[model samples]
Target chain A: MAARKSSQSHSGGLELLFSNQRKHKVSIPSTSDATTGQPSNVAFLIKWLCDNLMRDPRKEMFVLDDTARPGILVLINDADWELEGEEKYELQAGDEVVFVSTLHGG
Target chain B: MNGFSGTDHQVHNLKQQIAATETQLHSLKLQLQQAEQQAEAARHLSEAYQGGFPAEWMDETLVALQQDVTRDIAQKVRQEGGFEGAPSVRDAAQPRRWPLEKHEYKRYGRQLIMPEVGLHGQLRLKNARVLIVGVGGLGCPAAAYLAGAGVGTLGLMDGDTVEESNLHRQIAHSTARVDMNKTQSAMEYLQSLNPHVNYNRHEFHLTPQKAIQIFEQYDLVLDCTDHPTSRYLISDACILTGKTLVSASALKTEGQLIVLNNPPRPPGDALGGPCYRCIFPKPPPAESVLSCGEGGILGPVVGVMGVLQALEAIKVLTARAQRPANGGDWSTNGATSEAAPKATLLMFSTYNTPQFRSVRLRSRRADCAACSAQSTISRQSLTSGSLDYVAFCGATAPINLLPPASRVTATDFSRLPRDGSNVLIDVRDETQYAICALRGSVNVPWTGSADTWLERALASGLSFGGGRQHFVMCRFGNDSQLAAKAVMERTQTPVAVKDVKGGFKSWRDEVDPSWPDY
Candidate 1:
C-alpha cells in the first residue's frame, strides 16, 4: 500500500483530545479508499487521524459528520481550506494541515 | 615488640593531624557560605542601617511613601481630568493644545529616535483618541502600553468587580482591590503609569445606547471582552460608529486576534476590512462554550495577545493619524487617512513548537448580516434596544431543562443511604471531579460527547436495584437537570431519577459547609 506523510496540529482546547499533544506526524496509507478507487485526500487523512491519533473516546467533537467540525477552521499551507478544495483536495507530501477552534475567552 | 610499638605511635600522630585538619576545613567551608549571604546584607546594612536603625524600617517606610505618591497621582487625575461617571468635556473650556512639549520628546525619546516615528509620527500618536472596551486581561496590558506611548485619550469601559481569581491573568487589579470595580482599579494604575494621556472612565457595562455615543468620541476601538455576545455587540457598534476595531480572545492554551474596519467604510464596499461576523458567521454551540474559570488559561498566553493588540493599535494609529505638516486644527479630530489593514488571523498556541501562526482571511462577505448592503443591523435598531443579543448568542444564563418534579433539594438527596443500591452520578467535568467530590459519587461529564454514558454504565455491571434512587449533581444546577432527563430516556427499565437542586453550591450551604467552593 502506498503511504504519505503529513503534519497535523490542533489548538484552542482541541488538543485536549489528542493526548494533549499539540503537534504530531502521521503517515497515511495513500488511497485507503480502495473500494471507491479514490486517491488519498483530506477526507482520507481525517479518518486516519480519527482511527490513529484520537486518544479520547468522543470522536464527535473533532469530526462532525466525517469532516472537520463546524466551529473548527482548517488551514492548508497557511491558506484557508475553503480556498482549497476542502476535503476533496488531494494531499501532497510534507503538507502542513492545521485545525483550530475559535477562542472566546480572555 | 619495640618496632611494632614505634610504628603504632607514628600512625596515631598522623591520624590526629588529619582529624584536626579536616575539622578546620569544615569550619572554613561554613564561613565561606556565611560570607556569600552576608556580603549583600553588609552592603545594605552600611547604606540603610549602619547608623543604628532597625533593619526593616527602610523597606517599610519606602513602600508606605510610594503608596502616598501613587495616591497623589490618582487624586491629581481625579481632580483635574475627573474619572468614572464624570461627563466628558465635549466643549473645551480652553483651546485644544497640539504643540509637542519638551518633556514629551524626552519621555518618548527612545521611540522618537526611530525613522518610522520622528516628530510627525509622535504627533500622530499624541493626537489619536482610542476607546478600549472590557478592561480585563487584554485591556490591562494594552492600556498600559498605550498610555505609556502617550495616546491622546484612553476611554475605559467595564462593569465587573475584581476577584481573587482574576489576579493571575488580569494584571491591572490588585489584591487589596478584590471587590473594587475593574474600571476604577485599572484607571488608577494607568493614571500613575502615564499622567499625560487623557483618561475617560465609563464604569457601566457597554450597552447599545451608550456604545454609539462613547465610540463616536474616539477614533479606534478595541474589543477585549470575554464573551461572544459582547464580541457581536462590540463589532456591531464599531460598524455603526465608523470606528476601526482591534479584537482579541484567549482561552486555555490558545489565543486569536484580528483587525476589523481598518478603513471603516460604508456597507457594500468590498475594499473595506471585515468585521467579526464576516469571519465567524456562526457562534459556537451554547453548550460547548466555556469560561476561563471552567476552562483554565495560561497567564502568558493571554499576555502575549494583549501586548500584540497594543502593537497593532499603535501601528494603525501612527500610520493613519498623519496630517498636513502645516497648521489647521489637526489635533481636534480623528485620523484623516483611510488605509485598509491586512486581513490576517494571528493565532498563538502555547504548546505548539511554532507558537505563532498566521492565516490569510477573506474580506467582508456579501451576505453578512451586520456589514452588507442588505444588512439587518443598523444604528436605529441597535440603539432602539431592538436587538436581542442574549437570545442570539444562546446567552450564558441558567438553562431550565426539566420541571420541579424531576428536581430534589440537595438536603433531600443527602438523606439517601450510602449503599450501592442508590447511585449518585456527579456530571461535572473530569478536571472538577479531580478537584473534589463526595465519597460515593461517580463522574460522567454531561458536556462531553458521551451520549451512551448511561448505557455503558449499565453494561459495566452498575446496578439500579428496586426502590433505589438515582441522584444527579453538577457544578451549579443546570447540567444536573439535563443529565437527569438523559438518564430517564436512556434507561429501558423504569428507575427513579432526580436532580440535586442547586448542585454543589446548595450542598455546601445546606449539607456540608466545608466543601471547597472552587
Candidate 2:
C-alpha cells in the first residue's frame, strides 16, 4: 500500500483560517507593480501570495494545502498543475491561473 | 278665440321637462355597475394572497416591501438616514418587469432542436413540479439547470443552515449571505437566476411524516440525499405515493442515478406493482456505503449525476417516458426486452467509464417485509419488531450542514437593532457612489476584491479600529456580507460580524421609505 499521510495534521490553525474553500481570484500588481505601481499577472500574483499570504513559500506557481482543497489543485484553463511537475505551471502575460481546492461531492 | 290657441304652446313646454329627467336617471345606473367591477378586482388580489401564499411568507413579503426603492431620493435620505450608495432603478433606467406572466411555450428556438426535449416536451417541463431533497453539491447545480429550463414549480426541501464549507460546491450562496437560512437564500438565488420559475423553500427537514405531505405536492421527486437509510426511505415513500422518483448519488469520481416509477398502472392504481422493495427489499448494511465525509467525491462527478437526474425528472414530469415496466426495468431499446434478464435496471458507475449499466433486478424477496406479507417474516409478528425505519435513517440526526450567513438590507437591521448591537456596511460599486450611501457605517464596496476595498478604505484615512461590534450591510444584502467577511479576515479582528438582514430595503421598510430601494 502506498504510504498515506494526512497533510492537515501539521497546520491546523492555517486550515481553520482559510477553511472557506471558496474560489476567490484576486489580481494584484507585482512587486515591481507594488513598488513602481504596475499591473501584475499570474506570475507576480503567485509570488506575492507565497511571500505574504502563504505560510510556507514553495517555488511553485500554485499553492496547494489542506487548508482549502485536498491538494493544491491548480487549473490553468484546461490543464491541471498536478499533471505538470510541481511549480511548473507556466504563466504568460495574459494567462489565467485558477487555484482551486480538490473537494468532491456526489 | 286668442286664449284657446295658447294651449298648444303650454303642451310643448311639458314634453321638454320629461325628456331631461329620463337622461339623468340613466346616468346614475351606469355609475353603479362600474363601481362593482372595481371592487371585484381588489377582491381577486386578496384571494390570491390568502390562498396561494401562507402566513410564514410574511418575511418574504416584508423583505420585498422593504427593498422598495421606487421612491424619490433627497427626501428619502433625510428620513432614512445614509443611503447605501448603491444603484437603484433610476440608475439602470430599466423598467420593473412584473414576475407573473402567462408565457406560451416558444417553439423553433434552441430547445426545439433537441431531439429528446422538443416543443411538446418543453411545455411539459414548464408545468412540471420537481422536489429536490438536498441543497448541497448535487442539488445546487441540478436545481439551477432545472430552473433555467423553465420548470414551473421547483420545491427545495432542506432544514439545514449554510456553513463556510458549503461555499466550495454550493455555488448558490454568495459571500453576502454568510449565515442566512439555506432554504430561503437558495430560493432567492434561484429566482434571480430565472424570474419565471416559481420556487418554494421548505425550511423544515424531510421527515417520514412530512415526506408524505411534501412528496405528494410534486409531480416528481429527486433523491439527492446522502445516507443509505434516507435513500431507502425515499425509495419506499416514492413507491407508496406512486410518484416518479429520480434518484442520484455520487462520491469520489463515481456516481449512480436511477429512475423508479411507481407500479405499472396509473400512480394510484389498485395493484401497486413492483416498487423499489419489490426488487431490493432490505436496506444494505451501513458499513457497505461511505459518504463524501469519509471517502471524498469529485465535484464534477456530482455535477454529472445531478444533470442526469434533472433530465430524468424533466422526462418523467412531461410524461415523455413511461414508468419502469415490471420490477426495476429501464430498457429504452424496446418493450419486448422485458423478458430478457439483461435489460432490467439502468445503472451508471463513473469508476470505469461514464456508460450506463443494464442489470436484471430479481423478483420480490420472500422474506422482504415491504412486499411479502405472510410469505415473508411479518415484522409485526417478530419478537423485536423492526426498528423505526425513519429513525434508523437518522430522521432525528442533526444536519451538521453549513452555508454562509444571511444578509439583511438596511431596513431589516433597523427592526432587529434591539436583538443585539449591529452596524451596517455599504458594498456598492464605486462608479455609482454618487447615488447614495448609508451613514454611520463603513464603505468597502466590491471595487474588485480584498485589495481594492482595503486600498480605498486605507486611502480614506478612516478609523475601522477598536474591534467594533458590526454587521455588514448592502443595498440588497448581496455583496456587503462578503466584503465584511473578507475585511474581518484581513484585519485579524475577531468580530461578531453579520450581514444586515435584507440590506437597505429592510431598513427602508422598517424605518423610512423615502430612501430609494433600487
Candidate 3:
C-alpha cells in the first residue's frame, strides 16, 4: 500500500474520502489522475478508484458500472450524478464525490 | 262569433280552461316521479352505509346518480360556486359524500387544504388498503404515518417478536410490548394512533402461498422489510396482483426508495413500471449481505426512508383523484390516469456529507420474468408454488464450508475447559464487543487481517507450555469462520483453531440464557 501511494506523484491531485460503510474507509491523499492531466472528470476518478482503493478490482464493481447495480448510489458535489452528466461530468477543484450503499439491513 | 249562440261561447271558454288544468297536472306528475327516484336513492345509500358503504357501492351509486339526477341543477350549482368556495354539484352528489365524519375532516384539515389532496383525494386515502411487510425500523414509521393519514385498511405482517434492542429504531413497538409478536405490537400501536383504520394482523412469516392471496386484498404494498427474499417476494406478488409497490431499504447510514409495478394507465396497455428484478436482475451475493444485527445502523436513516415510503404510498393511492388535465404530468403527479408512472430511484445518505439523490429508472423490461408481457411468474405460478423466491434471491443461509473438526457447537464450547490455555477471540467490532461477550474472550474485531492481532496475542505470553487452542466467534458465526480460517493459515505456531458454530446466538440459545443476544 505504501509503495502504491509513493508510486504516484503528489502534485495537484484529488483528495478522496471513502465512507466507513464501505470495506475500505481510508482517505486517499493526493490521488493523481492516471488517465489524463490533473483535474479530470468523474470517469477518470472511477478509474483511479478501481486502480487504487478497491481490494479486488476485478471482482468488485462501483456505482458507475454500466449495469447500474442495485445497492450503490453516487453523488457529485451535493448534486445527483444524473443531473451532473454522470460519468461525463468533469471534476473541479474542491469537488466532493460520495458513494452510499443501501444494501444492508434496516 | 255574432252568428253563433250564447251556449257555444260558454263551451269554448270551458275548453280553454280544461287545457290549462291538464298542463298543470302533467308538471305535478313529473315532480312526483323525481321525488320518488330521490327517495329510492336515499334508501339505497342508507342501506349501503348500514352494510359499511363499500368502495364498489360508491362507484355504483355515482353511476346511478349521474344518470338519473337532473344535470341542469348540478350544472347550475357548479356555475354558482366551485367545490371549495360553496356547496357545488359534488356536494349535492350523494356518491361524493366520502363518508368522512365531521371530526375526520377536522383531523386531516391541514392535508385536506392541499389542492392535490382536497376532499376527493382524502376520500381516496380513506378508501386505500396498504400492506406493510415488516414491523421493524422502516415499517414502524411507515405504518404510523399511513395510519395517521387515515388509510382505511392497514395490514401488518411480521413473524418475529419484539426485542428490547429494537426499541431504538422500531418506534412502533414499546418497551412494554417487548416479547409480543411484531405484527400484533405494531397493530396495537397503529390502532391507538387511529382506531378508524382497519388493522389486519398477519402474525406469520410471508410465504408464496400467502403472499399473493394477502397482496390481492390490498391496493398497494409497502416493502419495509429488510431481508432480500421478502423484497423479491413482495415485488413479485405486487406484479401478479397488479398492486403498486413502494419499496424502501436502509442500511448503516444510507437508504433507498423506489415505487415499482404501479398499475399501468388504461389498464393492461403495457407492463407498468419496472419490478425489483428489472432494477437488480439478481440479488447481491450472500457473502456480501449484512443485516442490521450484523452491520449496525443508525435510527434516523431508516426513519427517513420509512417516512418517504408512506409519502409514495399516499401518492400512488390518491393519484387518480389528483389527476390533472392534459393527461397529467408524470414527473410531478403522484398518481395519474394517463402515462406510465415515472420510474425513479431515490438514494439518501446521512454520513460523510449528507446527500439525497434521485436517478431516472428504465422503463419496464420486456424480459422481466415477473411483470413482462410473456412473464413466467403468474397468479397460477405463485399459488402453485412454482416460484421459489428464496432460491431466486439466494436468501437461504449459505452452507458452512469449514470441516467439522474446525468447528465446535456452543454446547461443546461451554463444556470445554475455561483455563487460560484456551483463548477465545470475539471477532465482532468494538461497539458490539462492548455490548457483551464470553467471560474470558478477548476482542480482536475482524478488519480483513488477523496477523497483527495474532502476533500481539502470541507476544502477550498467554499461550500455555503446550500448543495453544484458539476459538473465534462473532455476533453470528459467519465472520468468525473467516477469522478462524485466517488464524489457522497465518499463525506460525502450532495452534488448534476453530470457529464457534452459530457464534454468540448459539451460545445464547444452547449455552447461557442470561447473555444478551443483541
* Model number with the top DockQ: 1
Q: What is candidate 3's CA lDDT for residue B128?
A: 78
DockQ, all candidates in order: 0.35, 0.07, 0.27
Candidate 1 vs 3: which has more lDDT: 1
Please identify model 3 stretches exceeding 4 Å from their true place: A1-48, A55-100, A104-106, B1-99, B263-271, B322-341, B396-399, B408-420, B437-441, B448-466, B506-513
What's model 2's TM-score? 0.42
Provide the lDDT at B210 for model 2: 62
TM-score of candidate 1 relative to the true fold? 0.74
DockQ of 3: 0.27
User: What's candidate 1's i-RMS value?
Assistant: 2.1
Candidate 1 stretches with Cα past 4 Å from truth are: A1-5, A17-21, A24-70, A85-88, B1-98, B321-342, B402-405, B415-423, B444-447, B450-452, B455-461, B466-468
Of the true interface contacts, what fraction does each candidate have? 0.64, 0.15, 0.43
State which docking tier applies to candidate 3: acceptable
Q: Model 2 residue B233 lDDT?
A: 62
- Among incorrect, acceptable, medium and high, the docking class of model 1 is acceptable
lDDT of 1 by residue, B1-518 (tens): 99999999999999989977775665455445444434444455456445654444334333333343344444434444334355434322221122356698789999877866655556668768998898888988888899998899999989999998888988888999899999899988888888998999889898877778889999899988888888889999998887889999998888999989766767776656788888777776665677788787888888888889988998887666323357532221243334333368999877666788889776787888888787899998888889877788786678787778888898988887677677888888878899999987877777443355565456645555577788889988878887788777776788788899999999999999999977
RMSD to truth, every model: 25.6, 25.1, 11.8
Interface root-mean-square deviation for each candidate?
A: 2.1, 14.6, 5.8
Instruction: Give the least accurate 10-residue stretch of model 1 chain B, judged by summed lDDT.
Output: B90-99
Local error of candidate 1 at residue B182 (angstroms):
1.7
Candidate ranking (TM-score, best to worst): 1, 3, 2
